[model samples]
Target: MLNLLGLDAVAESVYRGILDRPQDVDDLCDRLKLTEKEIRDALDRLSEMALVRPSTEDPGQLHAVSPHVGMEILLARQQAELASQKQRLEASRAAAAQLILEYDDRRADAGSAEAGVRYLEGIDSIRDHLAVLREQVVRELLTFAPGGPQTQANMSASRPLNQQLLERGVQMRTVYLDSIRSCTDTMKYVHWLTEHGCQVRTVPSLPNRMIIYDRKAAIIAAHTENTAAGAMQLTSQGAVTTLHALFESVWQSAEPVVRQARPTPGALNRQQAEALRLLAQGLTDEAIANRLGVSPRTARRIASGLMDVLDADSRFQAGVHAVQRGYLPSTPL
Candidate 1:
């Protein structure tokens, strides 16, 4: 291989001999025991590598280039190539670093003992991590959600994961605020969950949202003045266990949802029910519609209907009437 690259042992020996003194072809041939043709061939190869040059003193003789000079030229070419490669590598590394930083910002609270935190950057990443935890939740799954009903978007994201957990015989328990009982989408979800052998309960008020999986992992939203866009995952077993303990304490104080009393007929339509539920939770009509998978116009119409039924002039009054008339379940108030 070295010979294929314009170099060989014979060429090196010929170059070394020439370095001692300019040698005519006959002198080189006699000293190396090489035929004149062989000495000429070796010198030709060395000349091609720029390691030997024809002697100015004699047209038939050759002189070896100083090894230092030859090596300097080769090293400069190598250095230039390496510099180019380094520039490309640095550009690639910079782009990768920016991506990691952006992802870390989104998942800053999912602390890890590893060198880098395992970030759940997008909704897909969150789903994937949830799937892994669901698989590990052999014993139980617990949740406390105080916000409006799980949006259709959230339900769509979680359904497949919940099904997988159910298939693995994992036990599930969910506690929701009483407002969920009035949400058509939530009712649908709750019905599905019950059918899958999961237990569910309702409390009059919920302080925050939480999910604990197998006493191993917990997800909590940061306590910010602006609660949205501030969430974190906790993977410490001890901390997760404490959250689970809190969930159980709340669970014991909640009321079991009576499946028989679930509205079947003469209940509000899905959109209207979702609107009323969100309104009761103090969500604006726009946010309610966004969560309910409906248009804002439809949400406004629902709110209007609720007001008419409650014989109230404003949303606040309507909410008060609904609560008083048992439109919402009264549980552990």
Candidate 2:
């Protein structure tokens, strides 16, 4: 929809009318059944987007650019913005990583939790902190739930809070692992979230478990494999802002949760591509399974299937064939 490209319904309708034939303000108002002011406002927006231009024959009139040209312009602009955001995200990730390393090195020497970071020990402590933050949220909540499929206990415990937030009209966006598609209970909970106005999406993997409240505070897992081990609550502006940017980058690239998560025609699915990447790096099945949040057996099955598709006799051969077939953009090695 044009809304995805930042065009509202009224503006799109006005552009369509103008595309049919060059139109003056009066003509657009008559054709669209909109008031003169509305038509003029749409024209102003369309003009700024370069979707509309002044008519050559009648300077007072405005004309629509061809649909192809207009759409290409919009797409190109969006692509550039996405690329810039990605760069910022990468920089933020690097900076955050370095800062965390530094903080960890000095924590014992300086004593107490470092500025901008609070160490939360145990699951209960993390949950209690989240409860307090939940009550304080005034706007949006962004989360990364990377484990393959959520546990029933966790989902059940979260529903009431989720419902209250939805009722209060706060925006909630969550990203989960793509492997969740294989879990009925997880899918059911995802459907419930969507039905109640929360947006959910899935990706092949996530960096860690995280929940950012209002983009001003965030809690990130201390251990990627065992989040319950501990967590760090971050409140520093620079760190929180960086994590917020990271979430936005991931969210924009993630696919919405649906009945099926399909790959593009003749291309590898995200999971398979990620597996191939890891395989190329010579990771063991257990390691790959850990990263993917899947069982070792499932990881082996996926690897075997990929080998069969590539007509490869070994994992190394599979990686080679994947590259030759353009399944991978060259091995990370």
Candidate 3:
């Protein structure tokens, strides 16, 4: 049961045996029916993990650390490791973005464009490309509108094009953030779009904004923090197919906006569950906001609420409590 904390079967048995009563290697072997060698090995491993310490009064003796203290030590180690991993991931993202930019530059200098991947900068360029694609697309449109609520101007501007597409028998499906449920105008626009024969759904969060035209090409935000800065238009079969799969995966679990979705019994709601997962990943409120398409304040509130619910004093503690309560998987997802 304590395996998640780095304890194996023998180590856990040794821990339990010495928890309240410090046991020598002989006593442990006698109680656990293990060899003296196994008992000593478990003690050494436990000591290295800070779950057990040598007794000062008896040089050959070992005692288990308090359960609470041991757990805190293990949790702190996990949290540190998570923070390091998060840093590496951030660095990798930056590196990938740089490589894309360099590759695009090389293509531009060659005076010929690749057929598969192309980069477009500025809002006007993206809009122009979308307009051209809209006129040409014959089959379907799949989009992820990640930012929480649409602006009135954008909604008004999109209505005509959306109506035109729908009138031409295009299949349109969009997924938006669940936070839009609280925005009156956004909900009204969603209702209007639904009435116009578009299918719309909501999820707890989205990775980024994306639009796929006829499953042949996809446009994704070039900069996660500022979508207006640019976009990457991918026509590569492999990339487009992968994105389509991602959309389908999210769509299968998303709830339609026309009705409220019920949560599983004894489980956190999707939003809270997602928030806790992000919190455990060592994300800042701002980073959480970017993923969830909500303000940082909103992200902080959701995280704080989760901590309170778990009766945890810190983010890592919240994660530990969540695991203990079966709110999160023993192994991080």
Maximum-TM-score candidate:
2
> Which 10 consecutive positions of candidate 1 have the poorest summed lDDT?
77-86
Residue 260 in candidate 3, Cα distance off native in Å: 2.6
Write down the TM-score of every candidate: 0.43, 0.68, 0.67
On residues 207-291, what C-alpha lDDT tens digit does candidate 2 reach at each position?
Answer: 7788999988888887777889788887779878878887887787677885333233345666777677678767899988977
- Candidate 1, residues 1-333: lDDT per residue as tens digits? 123123567776787788889888888888878888888888776665577887878867777788787664333322211112222333433443343343335444434544233444444555566666766778888887666567898788778878888888998898876557668888888879888888988754444556787777676544412235444566655556556666766676555664312223334433354456557668887776555444578678768877886789988788777667656534311
lDDT of each: 0.62, 0.78, 0.77
Off by over 4 Å in 3: 1-112
Q: Indicate which candidate wins on lDDT.
A: 2
| Tens-place lDDT digits, model 3, residues 207-317 | 677899999988887777788988877777877776777787677767788865433334566677767767777889999888887899989898988887789898888
Q: CA lDDT of 201 in candidate 3?
A: 91
Between candidates 1 and 2, name the one with more favorable lDDT. 2
The candidate, 1 or 2, that scores higher on TM-score is 2
Q: Kindly give the stretch of ten consecutive residues in candidate 3 with the minimal lDDT sum.
A: 79-88
